[model samples]
Target chain A: MIERIESFRRRRPRLLEERVTLAHGAGGKASAALVDAVFVEAFRNPLLEPLCDGAVIDLPGGERLVISTDSFVVQPRTFPGGSIGQLAVHGTANDLAVSGAVPQWISAAFVLEEGFPIAELKQIAADMAAAAAETGVQIVTGDTKVVPKGAADGVFVTTTGVGVIPAGRDLSARSVRPGDKVLLSGSMGDHGMAVMLARGDLAIEADIRSDTASVSPLVESLLAAAPSTRWLRDATRGGVGTVCNELAQACGLGVLLDEEKLPVRPMVAGACELLGIDPLYVANEGKIVAVVAAEETEAAIAALRSHPLGADAAEVGEILEEPAQTVVVRTGFGGTRIVDMLVGDPLPRIC
Target chain B: MIERIESFRRRRPRLLEERVTLAHGAGGKASAALVDAVFVEAFRNPLLEPLCDGAVIDLPGGERLVISTDSFVVQPRTFPGGSIGQLAVHGTANDLAVSGAVPQWISAAFVLEEGFPIAELKQIAADMAAAAAETGVQIVTGDTKVVPKGAADGVFVTTTGVGVIPAGRDLSARSVRPGDKVLLSGSMGDHGMAVMLARGDLAIEADIRSDTASVSPLVESLLAAAPSTRWLRDATRGGVGTVCNELAQACGLGVLLDEEKLPVRPMVAGACELLGIDPLYVANEGKIVAVVAAEETEAAIAALRSHPLGADAAEVGEILEEPAQTVVVRTGFGGTRIVDMLVGDPLPRIC
Candidate 1:
């Protein structure tokens, strides 16, 4: 019997058992089956199945787009406030959103270390699906690769997202100029402190939780309200300090932040003090820093302060043409210290 | 001192102490310093120096493109034939190429396991730079995070590549049809087998080296010769078997391969016999499986044969509409066996 492409798919590979391991994540066999059995089955579409390297997405109303990729390797796999799965979704989506893109689709690639818990894998998949639903982006495509037990941490996730930005709404750090106002969506240090608490760093016992969640909606609101918004950045890897330093450098302007105005929860501050960590340099998963033109700053603040995700929004800083390309923190005592990107890994405690 | 965006240089973070540790890769302070000292310093440019969340690249020729992301977490980070560094470049580039795109620029993100040798990282970085340069792509942007020792293996690398395919190049498994010819470029299983050999699994070692090289040039040649080529798949992950099966399913056709025509190296085949692994399922980093129309099969083969990378290329199979979506292998003895994607991890090896 001379068979062709279609004939063989009739005898598609079956999931060997109900347990998950690193190999299943290896972007190979197990990964394919996992996607077939879970993600593809959940999100059915022609674009999802060709399993093309990445989703060749078509933007609604027609416009060229924005794309981003991120990998999540959170230790403890399951965290106090969220799982690695949830973090993967929000973390990547936010990356796209802050870039001023309407987050649409994401490609999730998982690297499962050998012998990982199967239930954990399914749970992660479920979380991924749910997060996708919330973000209005589907897990359009993925790859799995399995390495030997010693090759990886329990699991690492790499996601690439594609989003469309409507024309005429420019969002880049270079757009910031003198008199632009910096707006923070919510409290800082909660996510970092929560991780320390999860690690049981000390008896100080922080009740603060990771603020990880989808921010596309918040970003959408801001972009709509502040059409003149110059830049948007989420405080993630290198936290606020790193992002601000980047912004200043990108715009050739100085970013002056009033330290007392930053929204830091009491418990997070206590944890940071006890741990000797600078909250400014530590990672934050759920917050964003937006630089809006001075004219729209008030309306933008009002719009953000009314949203659930940004009710604690604060006007923490301003862009100045003087002292260009530096982040200067105005101390509570009226003095200023140069705030720079944490050049090295700031908190060696977490991945 | 104040500096213009053009004049501004990223500052080095204050040191905790001498000597890098696992904690440095933890997405904290140390990770930042490592990025500033090494990667940022090495690949400084206007587009990269800002260290934004993701690079806003100018897609050449204004074509809608394909973007793929991959993270390399192979154990032994460095192996006899290659290191995770080169693997990162190859893996991401191949992902884009197989999707029928001209692999272009890449962004690399490293999660360095703390206390790992700096020299090792330097080597990986050099390999990455060399690989990108050779492939006509630039490592336009990158990020580094360090995690303390116990929390990591040696190191893990994540690379995201974006490539542009000419409009109307409808290449996909779904396009394979009856009367199509399936071709294999060079030998199979060298890459995976090399991994096994590197691990010292067998007493009878084959001189078989890892077929770890870029397949984009080969793909370019095949497309140029047979512009109507149906599908081009790198037989990675689940190897040739899975690729055939994928084509079969996508085209709603069956594919039958003549076993004798497959270019399996004798030594690699012998080693597989001793190890009980199917060469069909072992990963092939460098080889590609292409299915093309009946009319230009010889021209496709001729084009492949001309390239050193595709010297051993051969037409191994034919596609038929009957018995849709199945893969059948005609044995040397005139019998046939179904070749399907593996149900689980084949060897649980890293990419």
Candidate 2:
């Protein structure tokens, strides 16, 4: 069986490169291809078939379990508004939350550089604890490993979260249909810009803070009000453009986004313009993209708006039947243009 | 309530060092201090109180879940008998297995350095898949992050596993008694020596292979034969000595080991002798130290020896009532000496 699986995997598309590039981790086409050719092809299973934000496991007693893991290697360990520790917790928790699960237990593993500051490590743990507490989750288990001084940056944290999905709350892109409403939880580009400014390599300054936060509360509210929501996703590494492109491809439908309806803060928009980057491609740590039934759009938006994290929520797009497996953006100037996943991220290691 | 927990945690011990040292991750006294002051104090919760290899969580419907996370940062990505990927899978699975749980699913998160070899990454994924398949477990989900070449080592894989405990089975240090017998599953020092030789830093070489295979089958067999087993632990990072010391401390009992009965292969013994290191302090990736009731020792040893992974199983020690919270070895030369956890590992990054 192992030999058969290996042979089957080898017949798939090859990565065709000696070394991995930044593009392979950009959460775009190259990233998808790498994962497909390497991991998914080798470890194929029914639970991973959907390629959703998290894998849902059916228990013996009619309960559903959701599990997700994420590794954070963000440069400049500490940035405006949050640190890597907090991001590690929120990232995994958000994955579970968007999958319609109530985030519960999390396990953290840390790889630290030999000479990393002990004070900073403590601060990171404190940040993680605070975030987990606020989200009503527990950091149940953890492991720590230290490497030689030059072997690692400062610290990298990997967090795995487990949650229980409420009965009758299945969410997946396969459930999306034409005319479904696409909603944005809040503004974009804050996290990317904040990390860039923190790096101080661009000689540009901005007073933007990362929107790194837990979106579980907002998700609970939205699910309670709009139980028929088709799907939900967090726009983290690849931002909104990549998310919409993935959804379009996964659902085998077209997504028509309106640029005028995009919730972009003025400062974030100005920063992206200055950096020669598209706001749509910048990461947002504390945002969600939801597809709801057209009739339930009002309830979804209203429920999201009641939360502090979703105060700026807006209906930014709609699913379409034409131009299958693609994302098209309607510009403020009344022209439509295709928005493909960026070949590579403009700001690497932003999250 | 959250504020109260945070405030209470703040009054615990502090990590008073300016920078982290190798000792902080050595799985010794310093490591314990670091974990207590930083992580345990911050993330205190009922599920983590045992501080065992894995955390056991009770579900709403009387089902028990075991979860564990570990990050592999071995210097040589591929050692003689296993690669980091295999170790990542087996390490996490063994944690769940030893906790008397049926290993079910795992999630892997990887942080790869930009420019790392794609072939190596593919090989790692293949190894992980094979290990998971052999263990009857699934790699349900994963995340990948890439850091700039200089910011990270070649690659680091963190695996988190989840499993369900079978009914009528309970294992913990608290279940250990003064009359319990300690058994070593197989030979020691193979993994640590193999990794050291693979590094090629030392002038000596040996034909030692790492014992980095899954022990879940062996564990299940033992449980079937001796349902009264008190505790099971894998002697991984800090080896059997550290595990015995921890068990002794946790159970408030003393352990007395017969040095002549330790199951160490001749090659590993010779290598350790040449390197001036004790086999007891060397890591073993696939070996386990099980404590069972005195009456069940025969059944436990018989069951372990029947398994391929535990062909060299031996009863090496016994728990004692006197000299609590310590380990003493009865040397072959007719004397006894205390065997405490090392101040720091002689071989760092051995996994």
Output the number of the lDDT-best candidate.
2
DockQ of 2: 0.53
Relative to the unseen true structure, what is the C-alpha lDDT of residue A187 in candidate 1, on a scale of 0 to 100?
90
Indicate the docking level reached by candidate 1.
incorrect
Tens digits of lDDT, candidate 2, B22-68: 87776665666678778876787664454343478888877889888
Question: What DockQ do the predictions score, one after another?
Answer: 0.06, 0.53
Q: Summarize candidate 1's per-residue lDDT along B1-351 as a digit string, tens digits.
A: 000111112224543434333323222223344333433332333433332212222233356466666667665565667777778888778877777787875656555565555446656777776676557665543434444455456666777777777666767655677888989999988887877677675587568777777888888899999999987778876678866765665566788999999888998999889888888878888889889999989999999999998999999999987777678999999999988665445354446
Q: Candidate 1 lDDT, tens digit per residue, A68-151?
A: 666676666666778777887888788778877778666666666655554566577777766777788655444455455565
Which residue ranges in model 2 land beyond 4 Å of their true spot?
A1-16, A45-53, B1-16, B45-54
Question: lDDT per model, in order?
Answer: 0.67, 0.85
Encode model 2's per-residue lDDT on A1-351: one tens digit a residue.
Answer: 111122223333346667888877777656766777778767876644543434788888788899899899888988998899889899989988988999998999999999988888889999999999888888888888989999999999999999999889888777899999999999988898899889988877778999999999999999999989998989987789988887887677999999999999998898888888998988889999999999999999999999999999999999999899789999999999999876665778877
Give the lDDT of residue A44 in candidate 1: 32
After superposition, the stretches of candidate 1 with alpha carbons farther than 4 Å from their true spots are A1-65, A321-324, A343-346, A349-351, B1-64, B75-81, B321-324, B343-346
